[model samples]
Target chain A: MSVDIKKYLEEKQQLVDGYLEANLPPIGTPPTVLHESIRYSLLAGGKRIRPILTVAAAESIGPPPKALLPVACAFEFIHTYSLIHDDLPAMDNDDFRRGKPTNHKVYGDGMAILAGDGLQTMAFEWCSRVDLVNDIEPYVQVQIIAELAHGSGNQGMVGGQVLDIQAENTKVDFAEIQNIHAHKTGKLIRAAVRAGALLSGANLTQFDQLTAYAEDIGLAFQIADDVLNVTGTREELGKDANTDAERGKQTYPSFYGLKGAKKLAQECADRAISRLSSFDEKADPLRGIAQYIVSRRN
Target chain B: MSVDIKKYLEEKQQLVDGYLEANLPPIGTPPTVLHESIRYSLLAGGKRIRPILTVAAAESIGPPPKALLPVACAFEFIHTYSLIHDDLPAMDNDDFRRGKPTNHKVYGDGMAILAGDGLQTMAFEWCSRVDLVNDIEPYVQVQIIAELAHGSGNQGMVGGQVLDIQAENTKVDFAEIQNIHAHKTGKLIRAAVRAGALLSGANLTQFDQLTAYAEDIGLAFQIADDVLNVTGTREELGKDANTDAERGKQTYPSFYGLKGAKKLAQECADRAISRLSSFDEKADPLRGIAQYIVSRRN
Candidate 1:
């Protein structure tokens, strides 16, 4: 019953990468600096997890349209843009990200900010203008845009980031951790999964189950990140180890001890997989992803 | 031949302000600090030129739907978000905007960045989800979104800002000045007019003439801003004046002396009004606005 999660993930990752590189504005576009800056970070490298979830979730229900690839890449752009801005001097202020110089270090701060701004706006362009296929309902397209915006907006990732910054050195309870994680990373992840389901025309029951599955895995993913922050090496994580502690950011490891956090991660993965019993082998990739999120070394 | 430009601008400004206050996330939202920061800058007050242009442009074509109000406010959010980011310590580092403390000055740098980010995302949220009317073509809505995204994105406003920041302390030529102004402020203004015309289903000729009209006035508006920076008092400008030269930002006044710059503005205004000759009284407000942009002291 075990799925070849590694192979499944790799194939999806390549699909998303292909779509992104092919569809992104060419580097020679009039303002070469901006286009270069955007491609510099966007094409740099990452796990491409968010986009893979989109492509996979859509596949889980049925074969998705070609438009799904651009749609998936749009989420990746949002994630990448958030990372670029987060690493700015005014925020997390990190010099490095994913084993490379941060955007600001390479492009200068103003250009870095604009690159992030450009990428964010481009994401919306890709999301709403899926003119390649007319199958997606108009309101559904609007809903997808609204969902992405909500996940990225004040009450979601942005608010979570504000709270995360302000909560440095402040004691946070379990609820606070849940709230931050749910909003910061979880909402976008959930939206990614739900967006795919909706695009594939999932029924209400299937949508509900997938939503639950996404919530469980989203939490598990963040917990693994928190656990890795304490236990993983810098080379393995592609970022500083214990940097979370150094910055006084509250984490699952900080709230629950090492053993407790690990147990929670496993439990979340288990719960996530359990939510897919309604589907047959079609959901194997999503289930495998839930497990991999916790099992990954990084 | 003249309209009550002052009263027209005032009424439109009030419409946008009312929409913003009534629609923005309440201050009591869980992350009240972030919400307060957004409202603080959004409602703090300015001319609301961009949004008024949107509403006015729509009205010029036909009786706009209710969704026009939200769409109009979305531009205001975009404008306000840019201002908030522009005032950040890493950028212009201004302490005050519109005679009050800037976002970062009151909320700290992290909050200000998040507030800007939040508002930017919210702008997208508002741009989408216009479920109120079916008169707008689905593609038209997406086109509106794309236009807004293009205007605000890297190749547009954000790109202009990057150039403006980098050009500080550097000698700039006339072409460079036009490039910056055309992209920075002009594109969005053009989009406002274009968005309205498209929403109201303007013919190709109307669209073309209105686009030219928008371009002329948009450049004129920036030239007016340059002139004001050189001559207006701090009390009238609501922000620092003559600071453009101090920051080494090249301006129209800097390139073409004050008198020459004023003459250029008049030419732009004249060309803008000439484009509206095709329309009857329906376009009087736009005609008046074109005149007002240069005539305005602040």
Candidate 2:
């Protein structure tokens, strides 16, 4: 029987939330404010797409979902950290995310920065500990750390952020926009997939398939984000709409217009799904995620 | 023959600088500004104490000095990153460091934050690559990543920074002061020595000896810094003097008067040296560094 993608996504999201709560540092750790700030944003409602990708990718091979919990939590921690920093007054300066006050809005700016630093550091801590609980090979765990460091560090998301900030009010070219999107969002997503495959000890050929699938959906997700920025309401998106156009940030819609951007998103979803043709029932959720990315208004 | 302290220190510093320059991402990478900022601060002159500690520890335990260069470079990167972030207007608000304008003063606040972040991420990247070049076990590389993640994260330096910030102008107790010092400057220094021992595959007994030595010297180093902030001139320290007191930040001087703090610093150096009794002549540099910590005005 065909699966309910909505039900599947909901169940996976629930799994991630429960795992995170169980694994994250308790709320009353010595530095109460910093810990509170970390939990406030981490437990705050979001799609949990990155962590879900990790768990889903792992399950697609052979391991149970719970086995990948630490890694999943690590990915979420990094995503949450990036969000907190991006919303700082020095960056995008958004007051709300997903209908709730942003981290800095509630925690104060200094605490907010520390909270981000804490989260980023904790993510690495968790990644380093994966071998302690799981049966993954020691070398593979190191590989996972390398992949994460590569994806999130100066060469990847952080570097992409610098470029995005520099591109403000400039006439950014298509190549530049693609470069920014690939590093800023795409690399982490790719790393998530690659990590899941590594946990199951997948060979090079299989890993390549997952990588291709992640890259296509990653691009699609970015395009969808651009479209949503134009169409999403403040109540739904939990952020101010039209900020991209207002700030003249380079985006797919900026380069290709709304209609062209939507077409591109659909094409990306199609290609991403095709990349998983070799897999069986386990791949369905990943396919569902690609569709959901283009479909979600937020 | 007694080693020339100045010549020995200069030679080691030069080794670390050369390794760092070779390994760091070059300028003209897509985000030129961020790359330049990282290089500007990292390559700027300062005591390469942290990295040198790692290399020296490794040498004492019988590894070649250059073999530990990557791990040593990683230590310096984290230290440099911390300096960049601490000098942010939201944090310490300092304009000059090592006699040059702070990163934010040159790169702007947003870019300065990114540069710090980039360096931190690269530190992890280098840590993960240790097994690539050396004979350290994969599990040991994982351990090094854990040590770093632990030392630099919220529970370590970052957490200490939050506590330090919150303690401003408040009557902080001696225990609280010790906790701040332990996490702030102490953990990274401890981790540096531990990294070197790990590189050399030191047995548990030897590792404990190194750990004890690191902790004592770490505490002494913090006390010396407190003393320097009071007694050192701008030209000698290469940063503003009296700013710690001016900012109302708690320090050793706050708990113990200048004379008492100096006495405590000497005690720490003595204890640190005693911990090195088991090692032969190879441990001389570590001994010299301990004495230098208490004696140097800057």
Candidate 3:
């Protein structure tokens, strides 16, 4: 039987949310607002898709190790920080995310910026904390950190963001947009998959397959997001709809019609699932996640 | 004989500058402006004090290892990124830094912010690159990453910045200002020393002594800065002078007056040197650095 992806995602989301809340500095912590603002955005409840990918990827290789939890949470922290910064006045200028006022709107731009800065540093902090992940090899931990930083740094997410900003309101070709998405969103997603697999001691063959699987889903996820931005409502998506067109951003939908974009997304999902054919039932969540990426409403 | 700190600092700075120039993404790399903005702020002339401290501290314990350079450079990267973000319009709103237009002024606010973000991630990336620091044990590398992140994260620099922002144009007591400086500037400086010491395998006593030395010098460095802000010329200082008073920020001079602040700084420096009495002539650079803290004109 196919895995019940909804239940799987929910369970994983709860696991991530609980860990983040427990580990985060409490509300009464010094610099209360910075901590509060960080918690506000982080705990504001996105789909936790990135972290769950980390968890699901690890589970595919072995039983989800206890140490996998923090790394998963680290990805969530990085993703949340990126969203907080992207929502700032200097970036996308969005006022809301996930149906709530963005961090800058509530905390003011300065604190929001600090909140993002704090979260980014904390991601590395969590990864390097030996006490939390003592069972994992120090060497593996270094490799995980390298993966996270490389994926998130200039060559990756931030580079993509720069490209996105440059592309705004300008005539951009298909190749340019693909390059942007691959660097911007795909790198971190791939890193999340690799980190999880690395923590679980995936062999070379397993690792390569997972990397291929991650790339397919990463593209599918972005294309699906582009499609949803056009088709979904603000209330349904918990964010501004049709923002890509408004911002003059080039997307799959911009190049192809809605039907064509959806078709591409489905093909990516299919390829992602097919990459897992060698694995047993343990790989089902990975399979389900690929399907879910194209089908999710938000 | 005492170490000639001027020549020593010059040599270390050259080494750091060369390494950074070589390892950083070349100018023609994709996302060119982002890379340019990062290099603009980083390559701009500054004292290179933090990384020098890392190198000096490592030398105090043993010959500075090849692996120590990246960690040393990591501290500089962290320092540069903080300055860039601090100069943002939403934050300090500074028009200039180090006698040059701030990153936001030259590159626009969004790219400046992204550049800073890119630099911050690069710091961690450098720390974890096994290829560059293979001589260092993975466990020690994790420890260094932990130290850097802890000293730079919420409980450290970012938290300190929040405190500094909150104290701006407000009445704050000596204890409050001390707390702010300890968190804001002191923590990272201490981290620099500790990371250097760890890289060179300092014994517990050596580590503790270095920690004590770092604390005293950290306070001294801030107090000296406070004095210079009040007494130094804009040209000499290479940035806005008297900004603390203009902003009504509480500082050592605000509490102690110029004369008293200088006295306090000297006393702290003396104590810092005293902490290094147990070490041989190898630590002369550390002692000289303490003296330089209070004596430098800007």
Which structure among the candidates has the greatest lDDT? 3
TM-score of chain B of each: 0.97, 0.96, 0.98
Please tell me which predicted candidate would have the highest DockQ against the true structure.
Answer: 3
| Candidate 2 or 1, higher lDDT | 2
Q: By DockQ thresholds, what CAPRI class is model 1?
A: medium
Residue B273's lDDT in candidate 1: 94
The lDDT, on a scale of 0 to 1, for candidate 3 is: 0.92
List candidate 1 stretches off by more than 4 Å.
Answer: A133-135, B133-135
lDDT of 2 at A178: 90
Each prediction's total of clashing residue pairs, residues at least 3 apart in sequence or on different chains, is: 0, 0, 0
Per-residue error for B223 in candidate 2, Å, reads 0.6
Model 2, residue B72: C-alpha shift (Å): 1.2
* Residue-level lDDT tens digits of model 1 in B74-103: 788888999998998778889878988888
Report the C-alpha lDDT of model 3 over A31-103, residue by residue, as the tens digit. 8888999989999878999899999999999986678888888888888999999999999999889999999
Predictions in order: lDDT: 0.85, 0.85, 0.92
The model with the greater DockQ, 1 or 2, is 2
Worst 10 residues of 2 chain B by lDDT: B129-138
- The sequence of per-residue lDDT tens digits that candidate 2 reaches over residues A1-298 is 1557789879988988988888777878877888889999998887889888887777777764334778777888888888998998888889988788999899887788888888888888988883554466668778888888888888788988998999899997899899898989998899888888887777787799999999999999999999999989998898788899998788898789999999999999999999989888887888888899999978
- Note the DockQ of each predicted structure: 0.66, 0.70, 0.82
Q: Which 10 successive residues of model 3 chain B have the least lDDT summed?
A: B130-139
